[model samples]
Target: NFILFKTISSCLFFFFFFRSYGGKILVFPFDGSHWVNMEVLLQALHSRGHNITVVRNSKSWYIKENSTYYNIITVPVERGIDQEFITNTTSGIMEFERGALPLTSFLHLTVTIFHIMIEVHKIFIDFVLAMLNDPDFLKMLKYSNFDLVLTDPSWGGGAIFAKYLNLPLVYNVRWILAKEAHFSLAPSPVSHIPITGTGYTDKMTFLQRVKNMMFYLLAQIHYYLMITQTYQQLCEKTLGPNIDFNELSLSADLWLMRVDFVFEYPRPTMPNFVYMGGFQCTPAKPLPQHLEDFVQSSGEHGVILMSMGTFVSALPADMTNEIAAAFAKLPQKVIWRHKGDRPANLGNNTLLVDWMPQNDLLGHPKMKLFVAHGGTNGLQEALYHGIPVVGIPLFFDQYDNLMRLKERGGAQILTLSTVDKENNFLKAVEEVLNEPSYRMNMQRLSRLHRDQPMKPLDNALFWMEFVMRHKGAAHLRTESYRMPWYSYYSVDVGLFLFGVFLLVVTTVFILMRCLYRTVCKPKVKQE
Candidate 1:
């Protein structure tokens, strides 16, 4: 067994080795969640001799500025308005006065989509035009012919660049492709596949399925009716109208979606849609001395690590105080990532820091529970470490994410709005900490996640390099992308079947009437 294992490992290594002959790869990562995962993959590819150049707007803050293997080119665009609006809205989810929109409301969802599309379209068009307007930058890109263009599908600029430069384009998604991307590339029937922001699962009730279908149709109809023409015009103005940005995007050579069966529900995905959900996660390193000592000193009671991710670092004062008070009563020590002053009445057992190494803390054996805002990045880390979660979901798929974890039996959720309730927060923490089943379930999942044949980084790197070597992996492109909407959904098939049924019923009714007129009328007259 040992000799056979060694032989197989050697062959796999050499396979990727020969395929590792590098190429110049261009990456366009915009969103924060995307940046975290894409950076890891980019670094891995860089180590494999690939030259990476990242093109991004000023709104992004997480891009590594000083890197030996990769280069960064910042595109100048008007940032303050859209960037400020997005930041404020995202932060407002946990703030009481801001009155964040509820995820369950269709109006809220519609408005959110409309707002995002308007802002994103503006940003995309402005960035492209600004870059095109710069002679030096345009000359630089024209001279440096990149081999592959990797992009987050949220931004259409990547598709524009690939089309203009005639480069092989690959999409890297930080979230599951259940949105518009799936509509084109995969089967997203509302019967089973849950909507991205909605909290429904694959085993949805009949009415829940209907609601899911409504959300899907509304989004699709809204896109085609409101945004399509304007987006086409933007493309025509910036890049030539000759190339359809939608078509160019749908023609992507490969798609790397941030999803895995361990974290997501089992669903059918296309051949090219590779799942590398936890690619950003790595084996936790030793914590800083102070943090390590804090956890060690917690004794048998263990520790709880709380963080709300980058965008939502601070909660409202009232909620913060409530959290502080709750932690004060608990025996377990809490290490919270807080930026400003400590909450009033903070307990001796709790410690606050400007930033905590979340993954490292979660990996600690004494870590008991994760109090989080339920962002994908944080959730994946918790799952990787096999720690049960106490989720306080605020907005934007956080609720849905936590609900899924709850279904998996490893998490318990509480809405941020209820933080002020007496003992609610404390009880949630206590229940998860005291329950053995949650811990057992999480450990089982952790084993499944870790016991994969290959690490996520390797899987991502292999697929990325494979696309580069195969010149886009054109054979992997499913016919789904090219199929028309009606055809793809089998809408035509349904209509055809309905038509045949209607025709047969009508013929039978006509024959019955004819028989009545031909024989029944004569019989009645004779009688």
Candidate 2:
């Protein structure tokens, strides 16, 4: 009886302690697949008794109007990066990848993607303006007394909003504006650190290094012309003339990076950047009875899982038939998440579902291989579960993500242009299955990923709460972002030193000439 009473008392004490200390966090999230991971962080924070208020748009693609974990504040907008936009953009990219020459394809693809991104940013800027210009919205936000703003820096409005509210800012980030988050927050040397979309690794040949620099410069130009100039105008008009958008974008109190060294190549990172790769991953829960029964029925042959992430629901009909034919040849039972018309060549061995429990399936004991489009979240999950991958890179950073795994020897890459030609898909799948090294290397990565001292999600939560406790994590942030480009790189200091050395040399030369004249004049007069 006494022990029972003690247990009850402890439970009550913790319950009250958590209730009293819970923070009020305001979330401004990016929609689509980015929301998928951001929602994971929100759920964790909600479990810890935090009060989460999510600011979403009326045209939001993935963020629902209602959720169990967070309250929604919907901002009405006419148009956004909705389903139609994504589908059309993806279709155009596919057309380019499948037909154009390599150089023409790259140039066209870059311009198209840049144009789409600019449109998205312009919409977000208008969204921010709508929120700021409304008096009632401003009053409500100010009265809420939020502790910090948690946001994804893929869009700039969140940072701008946080600055306007005078609240601390934290980012659930992998990309910031037009490039990888590290490029904004860390010292990125172009010689080693490969730019996104380049499909080059850290160890680059001289020609590759030159291409890497060109890519980096292109990204910088895109950011400056498309993002910085536009956002800077908005910042000045809304916040104050003194506000610099680039600095505001980098001035977050903490950065919860969505990658770790297990997946990412070695590079310099900032103190405020905390890697929480695979934070969304957990031990697989029990499968539904029907799903379990289907798995057990596979007998000696294990199951293969395939998904193309949130977007790209289905491929072109011919491409679909090609993939279906390859799966028909595989001995392993396959579960593929697909939409659109059923493939003509789909075998009885393959099951096509509109959706599947991807993580749970990946974690299953009988799971053998993952056929994926190489999204970051899916790749991290594959690493966590030790599943070898056959990556069919479609667009965006998909090729680069798969390249990282291929470099580590755990995955194979089949480009969209070649996925349907010459029996490539079937041969690649067979190669991974027949080879022992693929599974061995992947399992090795899984062990290393799981060997962290603290769970990635818990680490993320602690830092978030740490920011709340401390009001902000300014000490962890570097003031280098506030410096001018020349000042940050010490170009000005180098030039100053160079000028001083030249002055000393000039003065010494003048003095030597005078001394020579004095001595020689006396000698000449005497002669």
Q: Which candidate has the top score in TM-score?
A: 2
Estimate every model's Cα lDDT from 0 to 1.
0.78, 0.92
Q: How close is candidate 2 to the true structure, as a TM-score?
A: 0.97
Question: Which candidate tops lDDT?
Answer: 2
lDDT of 1 by residue, 354-408 (tens): 8777878888889999998888888988999999999987766787888878999
Model 1 TM-score is: 0.88
lDDT of 2 by residue, 198-273 (tens): 9999999999999999999999899888766569989999988998899999999999999999999999998899
Tell me the TM-score of each prediction against the true structure. Answer: 0.88, 0.97
